[model samples]
Every structure is written in structure tokens, then in C-alpha cells.
Target: MASNRRAFLAATAVAALAAAPASAAPADPLETTARPRPTTARAALAELLAGNRRYATGGSRHPDEGLLHRHALAAGQHPFAVVIGCIDSRVPPELVFDQGLGDLICIRTAGQVLDEAVLASIQYGVQELHVPLVLVLGHERCGAVAATLDHLRTGAPVPGHLELLVDEIAPAALRTRHLPGDWAEHTMRANTVWVRDAIRADSAFAAATVTAARFDLDTGLISVLP
Candidate 1:
């Protein structure tokens, strides 16, 4: 069932991408102001979850992509949420959540690993931009977490800066070793939770809410973890 869902989503993504125009000429700009931003974490999270439901059910409205929206965003962006997700080509936050321009502050890293720079970027979003919510989004079949599991089991050396990813993810892999499920999947969820907790613990992010979620590659659904 899961595999079938995954195949369906993959086909859907391909069809959508193929049907989309290569480029669109800018539409006449509308004289409009930016929409009101979500001021509370709960409100921000509700907006994201609603968008995800639209995407999962194939009812995406593709809002905020018009020329007026783009032009308004050029002045300044007040994204309501900060999404920390994997750098997977297939799991773009915008498309997955069905959000458009200036709706989210997206930060992607392999395995959703956090370093000084990633942390700083998230901090900026929460503190400077006053983004109300931060989402740590992990997905099924993450190559980075899988590689870390491989390295742990085989004691193999990963060459170059890629090893850094393995190193950061190793702790999550180790922590979840005793759990009764697929190692990679477990590690993915664990990593997401770990990062969420880390962000919540950070002093700079105290004003914002931090949460973790797993993206089902098969169904294109995002399940928020408790």
C-alpha cells in the first residue's frame, strides 16, 4: 500500500512538473498590500497544516504566486513560519505545502543537520523576522540517515565533507538502535525530534514554537509529531 502511494505521488509530481510552463511572463502588478502575517505560533502552524492537506488531497490552490504578490515580496518578506527540511530535490517545502512566494522561510540541509550557519539562519527568522513557528521536517528514505546507519554498521569511512553529515546524524541513529523498526526511518524521525528539541532549547528561539514532522514521500502527507 505504501509503495503504491509512493508510486502515485511520484507520477503525480512528474506530471505536474511536465505540464507546468517553462516560464511565465509577469502578470500586470496589482496595487495590493501584503497579506497579514500569522502572529502566533498556533496560527502559523494551522496555516501550514491546511496547506499540506490541500497538497495531499490534490486540491492545491497555489496561492500567492501572482505578479502582485511577487512584487510586494520584493519590498520585504514576512514569512510566518521557518521550515528546516532536507535538501532533497523531491521534497521542496513550497510544493509539498502548496505555499507560494514569501509564505515560508525555508532552510534545507542534508539530514536536516544543524551547524553554526543553519542555526544562525533559523535564529534570524525567528528573532528578526518574528516567524512564529519553526518546523523540522524529515522524510521517508533519507539518504543521509541511511548512510549514517551504513557507516555505523560497517565502520566505513565516508570521504570529504559528506562525512560531516554522517557524523551529525550518527547520534540519532545510535539513540534509536533499540527501537523496533527500520533503522533509517527511525533515525529520520529521531533526527527530526532532536533538531526540534535543539531549536526549542536555544535561547534565541524562545519566542517561537518548534515542532517536528515527517513527510510521507508516498502520500505527500506531512504528519506532525507530538
Candidate 2:
């Protein structure tokens, strides 16, 4: 049954893909925004991965940014996934995933830290928007992780409200200290896992598939972690 469901989803995604070029000058305008959305979490993840492949290989279609599509989306948004990521300027989720207007609901913080507001926003996406997937995206050599590591080691005060951000990421920095190799990278991965787990544990949020991933800056590739 699972395989059959996957096959059906693959066909639906193909139908959606074929409709992409028409979005350049969509006849109905809203038609582009109405493509068959991934019905399951695995299918949604696959779509995101496919988009990332296009982005990494320099073959992005840059779908759904057209003026007509923008106008159509003014009526409503039905994004497929909720991306929880870091505030790093380099890793814009839309660009990295090659998705466009109304395709993803994104919430970003330094180290992808979760607080009440972030959790609430994500909950709204899953419960109200019925988004199938929630991805916590971390990246290589994350600045937040590095800062937390340094601040924790030195016991120096971080300036301004930035201390709150570092403090949120402190657990990952401390947890990965015993691991070999680069501290920041390990902490970043650990932090993504922690955030993913936290979201899963949150009773307030509606049911959705939660996952963690890492993005490599040099390669422009994103990988889902085990």
C-alpha cells in the first residue's frame, strides 16, 4: 500500500511539474498556485529535495514568482511545508529549496531556536494551514553554534539581546563538546536534532511529520539527517 501510495504521489508531482512552465504566463493565473500539493510528509520532503537538487545544480526553474501568481496568492496561501531554520543571510530557504511565493511557510531564528512565538507560528502552520512537513534546517559552521560555544567556554557576556539566542543554543554546544572534530559543525547538527525533537514533543502543535537536516554552504546542497 505504501509503495502504491508513493507511486501515485510521484505521478501527481509530475503533473504539478508539467504545469510549472505554464506559470510563466498562466492562463488562469491562479492555476499555477493550485497545483497538486504533496499529500503526505514523505512526498512533501521529496518535493523539497527535488527543488534543492535543481538549486545545487544551477538548474532551478524559479517557479511561482510571476506577478499573476502573486496576485492569485493574495486571496490565500497553501504552503506545503514549514521550514524552521537559522537567521543566516546566506541560507534563504526559498532560494536554497528553489521554491517560490506561497510554496513554503518559513520561520527563522539564530540556530533555529524555538521559543513560544516560534512554536506558536509553527503550530498555526500545521494546524490551520495543514502543512504536511516541518523541517528544522541547520547548516555547516553555524554562527549561532560557534558563538554559543565560545560564550560558554569563556563565560563572557554576549552583548544585548543576542545573549538570549546564545543561551537557547547552549545545550547543543555543551552536549557536543565531547565529540571529535570541529565543535561548531557537531553542535549545529546536534542543535537541529534538538530542535526537531522539541517540536515533536510539543503537545500544543498539531500533528505533522518533523525532520532535521543540514545544508552545506560550499556545495549548496541540503541533506536530511538520519
Candidate 3:
């Protein structure tokens, strides 16, 4: 079943990519007011990594996301990057990465699963907001991952509607079952890598932006995949 879903996802991505405008084709949408400029993808990625490093080392320079910041962003926003992270309260992208309002376009889902809503949010980030980078942030000891691991090992279906999230993550969890160290932690990292690849392989956004980085919660460090 997992394999079938993966194939379905891959095919969907291909179709979306085929429909997207070619990268080389010239046609910039007309913009009113001053054009909203975004940082280069690499630069924006670096900033996020640096902030996460600070968070890990107890040296975080927290962003001021106060009332003034909110008001300034109400009329318009030009976030530099998009972060599709888990719904885990501990993994809030703004606080963990020390970013202010209008700094990041964030989308959260349980297990960081990609559904239509999440994909649309990502599309809006790249095509409309001109965000240069997108980060699929996943953390250690994720409850969703833990649940999936249980489902894989014990053959016990995740209870109730939670099965949907576990089902999405079970493939990645099963792949890492033989790896060294704690299985839960291993599964967590594997889940992060899997989600990262899912975004990179997406048809529409892959060509528009580089999909190449993951942040590990345990180390509070960013790992760039070649």
C-alpha cells in the first residue's frame, strides 16, 4: 500500500511539473508597487541554519515578533523562505529559527505529510511570494513517528484517525528498523530525510526552488544533502 502511494505521489509530481512554466521561458508577472525582493536561496538557508545552531547551543538571538511586526506584515509580506514542519508545539519554526514576522512562510502538518493544502501553500510561497528556499523541518522524538514505529514493529494499527498519519510515515519507519541506535530516533531522522525528498521530487516547486536541506532537532543543526 505504501509503495502504491509513493508511485501515485511521484506521478502526480511529474504531471504538476509538466504543467508549470519552463524555468528558462521569459515571462515575469507584472508587479504593482516596489517589487518584493527575497534573499537568495542559499543565503536564506544559511540564515535559518545559523539560527538553529544558536538554538541548539543556547545562544539564540530571538526575533521580535511583537505587535509592531504583526502590523507591518498585515498589509503585505515578503518572506525569504518557506518551512513545512511538523505540528509539534516544540518545533515552531519562528521561535526555533529566531525569525520575525514576514521572515518565513510556514506550513505545519502532523508528521509533515504532504496533502493538497500543504502543496498549495508551498506553491503560493514560490510562485506568488517569491520565497527562495523551502525547509521541511522534522524533529526528534516526534509523537507521530513514535506511533508509526509502533505500528511497524507490533503490527498494531494506529488507533482511530491517527492511522492516516502513521500510514503515511510507516514506510520510512520500516526502512530504518535495522539501523543502529534507538529505533525511534533513527526513524525520526529517516522521516525527515524522506519528507525532504518528497518536496524535492514535487513537480511544480522543484524547478522553482532548490529542495536540499533538513534540520535535525537533536543536534539543532542543519544538514545539507548533496
What stretches of model 2 exceed 4 Å from their correct place? 1-34
For residues 143-171, what per-residue lDDT tens digits would candidate 3 score against the true structure? 88888877776887667889789878888
Model 3 CA lDDT for position 147:
83
Task: Write model 1 residue lDDT over 165-225, tens digit each, in one string.
Answer: 9989999999999999798888999889999999899999998999999999999999998
Question: Residue by residue across 73-105, what tens digits does model 2's lDDT show?
Answer: 899999999999999999999999998899999
What lDDT would candidate 3 get against the real structure?
0.76
Q: Candidate 2 — worst ten consecutive residues by lDDT sum?
A: 25-34
Q: Which sections of candidate 3 miss by over 4 Å?
A: 1-38, 64-68, 210-219
For all candidates, the clash counts are: 0, 0, 0
Candidate 3: minimum summed lDDT over ten consecutive residues — where? 27-36
Work out the TM-score per prediction: 0.84, 0.84, 0.74
Which consecutive 10 residues in model 1 have the weakest lDDT in total?
Answer: 25-34
